[model samples]
Target chain A: MRATYMFGAGDVRVIDVPDPVIERPTDAIVRIVRACVCGSDLHPYHGLPATAEGIPMGHEFVGVVEETGRDVATLKKGDLVIAPFAWSDGTCDFCREGLHTSCRHGGFWGRNGIGGGQAEAVRVPLADGTLVKVPVGEDSALLASLLTLSDVYGTGYHAAVKAGVNERTTVTVIGDGAVGLMAVLSAKQLGAERIILMGRHQARTDLGREFGATDVVAERGEAGIAAVRELTGGDGTHTVLEAVGHMPAYRQAIGVVRPGGVISRVGVPQYEEAPIGFGSLFGPNVTLTGGPAPVRAYIEPLLPRVLDGSVNPGRVFDREVGLEQTPEAYKAMDAREALKVLVRP
Target chain B: MRATYMFGAGDVRVIDVPDPVIERPTDAIVRIVRACVCGSDLHPYHGLPATAEGIPMGHEFVGVVEETGRDVATLKKGDLVIAPFAWSDGTCDFCREGLHTSCRHGGFWGRNGIGGGQAEAVRVPLADGTLVKVPVGEDSALLASLLTLSDVYGTGYHAAVKAGVNERTTVTVIGDGAVGLMAVLSAKQLGAERIILMGRHQARTDLGREFGATDVVAERGEAGIAAVRELTGGDGTHTVLEAVGHMPAYRQAIGVVRPGGVISRVGVPQYEEAPIGFGSLFGPNVTLTGGPAPVRAYIEPLLPRVLDGSVNPGRVFDREVGLEQTPEAYKAMDAREALKVLVRP
Candidate 1:
């Protein structure tokens, strides 16, 4: 089987590797139909501690079950499914509360735990809880959208929801990447009246507008906040999604929200200690919430939308490559040549 | 009229000042029966920014309405009232949404707009929305407890409520000041089973126990968290009320809450920036909320309890002094000789 591995910073490769087999009773072996690189993957590719050592490179995927272990009850061979980024037991107190990411036995599919999806086949732990049936006989185009359900789309939605995006909200998303673009779609779906996309590139900015961004600000820092304020009648956006996890972006998200507004930060903060201005937050009374995407809770509802064609989040896939081209796909994504790179395994 | 003013750092003087008159059409002039020095006063006493100049001090008070402006409809002369630290018009969208502190026309009483409450007479702007009638004829002792309802007591309740304290919760309060001590009482009222008070002084800790702290932790940093963890069977507290706004206290509050727990921070953050580990918050799913106490909302319910002896938050005041002795009161509070200083003007 061909699989992707992070050799080091800026060193992603696709090479011949052994196929994953069921090592645990609750595991399932799935032949991945589609998968993609996540924004989080860049953390390791850029060489963060967790990804310093070469590790499996992908988590989001839709696939057909090739085999299942004895304890796997609901999943069987040839079942089409969407596996969330996190694998859980599905019955823990945390999982029951729909916080599967915090499940007691939960593990991220790729970097830290077992096999990931950017391969021909991979081992999935807690099959019953981790994999959701994608309704048999879904189209290949639908597969890409369902593939997104495995991570970014769900994460974007989670960020928006945490920030309390509603019909009356004016939201400014602080990134024009795939997740940020997906956030625009989610905010629109959730009835955000105005959506602002912050990005540097013209192409991605236009794509954001197409996906529901009511405006775009090419500037960064104080200038960006001024632009956002101008768009929001100088009161700032009611909700701002911080999808780019860095100091400047985080500050922008906090700065561009009105008094008593919320900043839903979905960008995985790479820094161990980000300086937060307590005075600003306390004075303006802003609410900050966001983490990893709770994909399991979202996959079910989102699947129906994808099946019915109400949402077209798959349009984010600007580049499609074969599994053998996984290394090139990572490069393209890293160099910002592609909004999203989908791989056919 | 007599008033307390901070001529500069370490200089508090009780001086003869002109009596406050109804300056605004919506204003009311009140004879302050009782007023107290607040933790925020220390910010100016220590000479921070705009407050470095000589300024009237105090934001918490219980008083009798001596006069009302032509536009005041809520109260007449001789009515006892609890005045919130913030004055709002209550006509703005922020006020309608119950965020009176963030009202467009809202202003802080002592430091910004209105004169300080630690004076014989206070000119309360937007009196109709700022002052709550103290159940007509409440006793002076009850009024003292009600006086705290103007600030710390209500702030503590706000912290507990924002932290989501309820019947089954185990709560940790991170400051032993008046507000922190009141938080212990508030937690009990909210039905929290195990209230842990974090303080260093024996007397304050003893007072905390009396105010419903089930346990006390005198340790400061990691040791404090370890003690709290041991108390909760290694899960940490369900809710953490950060009544001290300093960085260490803020970190302690964040460190001691369990996964999915809430941290309600109400203490005025004197510093501009503090380190925020987004990864820590995101991985654990902690909810952080708080700011200025929504005194208006809680004052109504709390007024009855204080009057009827159902609550005795006034016990947090360890010393009573005349307005002329407020400088010594500030020194005592700063030196930890007093938990709270009640001043009679």
Candidate 2:
């Protein structure tokens, strides 16, 4: 089986690897139907050092179950399904609390000897808890949108939900990436009155507008904060959905969040320390929230919207590639030529 | 008139000061009937450098409206009122949103030439907004609890409310100070099923238990975290109400919070930076929130409970001192000899 691996910074390749097989009674073998490059994957693509064995990649995927262990109860071979970024045992306390990302028995894909999703086939642990069955057929056009439920869309939804966005809220999203656009869509779906998208790219911001951003700010840093505040009547937005996890983005979140509002960061943070004392979050009563999205908990509610054509999150996939072209998929996304690159294995 | 002043670290004195007069149409002069030493007051007492012009002390007070400016509508002369620590004009976006602490026309009690609550009379700006009318008389037995509604009780309740405490939540309060005891009482009032009070003082913890702490963890650092984990089946509590502003209390909040839980810090943070990256909050989905309590917003709802005898937040005050003995009041609280000091002018 061919799988994606990063040989070093800016180096990605599809190489032959041993096929995955169900190794535990709770595991299942999934033949990947679709997968994609993520913005988070760029973190390693930019700084990961070369290794002898290389590192497996990809954490989001939709697949058809090829084989299942005897203990798997709710799923069977040939079921079309989506896998959240992390696998969890549904019965764990954290999982029961709808925080599957922190499940005690769960671990992220592509770690701890697990096969990456950007492969022809992968072993999924805790299959019953990790995979949400999709009623659509493998050939359904809704597959692309349904695939987003596994991570991006659900992540954006989580940011909005955690931030308490509602019809009375004015939101500012500080990224033009697929996740940020999904956040705009989610805020709109949740009934946010206004959304401001801060991005330099015209094409992406245009898509953001289509997704319900009522305003756009092309500036960065202090000027960007001024623009957002101006758009929000000098008070900034009620919620700042921060989908860019860099220090500057975090600073802008602090700058443009209204007093008593929330800053929800969906992007994987690139830095650790940030100001949260009286000078920032504490003085204004700003809430700092957001984390690895527990997409497993969100899939059930968001799936119906995708199936009903009320939302079109698949528009984020501006490019697609075949299994052998996975390397180009990474390059295209890294070069900003593609918002998100879909992969067919 | 006499007012409390902090001339330097470890120094508090009552000194003659000019009587306050209304400087704005919205202002009213409050004759101090009751004032108290706060944990936060100790911050300046412990570290404030010596100065020619000493900082005025105290922010919590229940008083009589001695005089009101022509524009003061809701309050009149001789009315009994509880003033929140901060003053604000009631008609601002932040105030309208129930975030009076962030009111556009608001300021703290002791700053900007305003008289502190410990003075013989305080000229309260935005009288209609900052003071809540208390139905009880100055001689009522509930005066102590009503005084708490000005700061301590309201601040603790803010922590619980911001953390979203409810019947299903297990709460851990990280302080035994007056505010911490108030937090235990607030959590119980909010219906938290399990309340863990983390403090070492026997008398304080005993009062905390009476206030509804189901368990007491007297250990600090790792031992404290372990004790809390053991109490919650190794998952920690669903909500951590942090009433201590120091870094250690913040660290303990991180150590014992369950995944996807909330940390509500009501205490004024003494530090500016803390970890919030993958190694801490982000990975576990912990939401960091809470700030200075908008006591003005909380006073109305909590007043009924205080009046009805269902809650006794006033029990936190263990000692009393006259205005002339304000120096000793600070000493007793600083030495932990008194849970909180009630001041009579």
Interface RMSD score of each model = 2.2, 0.6
Kindly report the root-mean-square deviation of model 2 from the true structure over all alpha carbons.
1.4
Chain B TM-score of predicted candidate 1 relative to the true chain B: 0.95
Every candidate's lDDT? 0.84, 0.92
- lDDT score, candidate 2, position A139: 98
**TM-scores for all predictions:** 0.94, 0.98
Q: Model 1, stretches more than 4 Å misplaced?
A: A48-53, A200-211, B46-53
Across residues A51-133, which tens digit of lDDT does each residue of candidate 1 receive? Answer: 44467878888899999999999988989999998888899877877788888888887645587788888999999988998
User: What DockQ does model 1 achieve?
Assistant: 0.55
- RMSD for each model, in Å, please? 2.5, 1.4
The whole-model C-alpha lDDT of candidate 1 against the native structure comes to 0.84
TM-score of chain B of each: 0.95, 0.99
How well is each residue in B1-345 modelled by candidate 1, as lDDT tens digits?
A: 888888877788887778888888899999988899887777667774443456788889988999999999989999998888888887888787677888787788765546898888899999998888866563555767888888899899988987779998889999888889989999999999899999998898899999999999999999998888888877788799998888889888877988777778888886666655455676776766788876777887787778789888888888999988988999998887888899987
The candidate maximizing DockQ is 2
Lowest-sum lDDT 10-residue window in model 1 chain A: A271-280
Query: Residue B196's C-alpha lDDT in candidate 1?
Result: 93
**lDDT over C-alpha atoms for residue B105 of model 2:** 91
